[model samples]
Target: MKTPQIVELTSTDIDQYIDKLCTILHANVHDGASVNFIVPFSFDDAKNYWKNKIQSSIEKQERTLWAAFEGDNLAGSVQLDYSMPPNQNHRCEVSKLIVHPDFRRRGIARKLMAQIEDKARELKRQLITLDTVKGSKAEPLYLSLGFEIAGILPGFSRHPIENRFDATTYMYKNLAAKFDG
Candidate 1:
């Protein structure tokens, strides 16, 4: 696949790509990605999530979303949430890094992550945090990207397709050090 073009998405852009975004989310959930959904998840569920939850956050400027596109197709997306309290303004959270399964192993997720990290730095955030299902494919990716494991929460989340619970690993990167003297 050709290199995807990563673009920061505005509220309008979110509306325009709502269906593609929902498709990616639905596919990931069904593919057993621990993305807060279960096997019976439906297309409407994904649409509601993007429209109701994510779109509002974008409009409120509480979070920034980025999408990776390859030849008019949305290959992946990720979000950077910086809507912390005033005391925590220096920190941000990375969430919902999803790539279409068909587009996996093509560096789409990495590109999406790079976009969000750049956005975090632009917003003056010094700390970037995220959580992933322990032992999931995303864990190694996060570690490879310089995120250090902060802690692991036992039985923190339910597996998307299975009845068993899954542990979650919280990871963080300290961007402050990179910018410090």
Candidate 2:
């Protein structure tokens, strides 16, 4: 997938979002993403995950899902989670950034993150937080995108494939004035 078209989706786009998200989640987990799932990743597992977790969340206005398409195929997606405590209304979590294994290294993730940042700023979410497997490829990507590493939690999760415990890096970016020039 080359320069896939990225668009923000809502509950109205539930079916398409579920289909694309299922594929992306399965591909990422199968490719060793170490996200919330263990090995034996299956398409049904991915499909149900989105149908259950994401569909309701989007309906509740707690998350914004963005989908990327490569010639009518759902290639990737990233989500912004606003389901935070009332006190932290100015912040949100960036989670579930995934790209199909076949669509890796095509700048889709970068574009998704950029659009997410734009969305956060638009919503006046001054602070954005996210965590990824420490020392994973995504760590550097977050760093390069101006997210500051707050800390790392050791043995945060176990690799679904390698079976080794890995740390998780906590990152934060203050977008209060970013791109407001």
Q: Please report the TM-score between candidate 2 and the true structure.
A: 0.93
How accurate locally is residue 172 in candidate 1, as Cα lDDT from 0 to 100?
94
* Candidate achieving the largest lDDT: 1
The residue ranges of model 2 lying beyond 4 angstroms of the native Cα positions read 178-181
- RMSD each, Å: 1.8, 2.7
**Considering every candidate listed, which one attains the maximal TM-score?**
1
Q: Write one digit per residue (lDDT tens) for candidate 1, span 44-119.
A: 9998999899999999999999999999899999999999998788899999999999999998988888888888
Model 2 over residues 1-181: C-alpha lDDT tens digits? 2568999887778775666677778878888997789888888898788888888998998999988889988888889998889988889999888888888888888999999999998888989999999888989899989999999999999897886899999999988766342
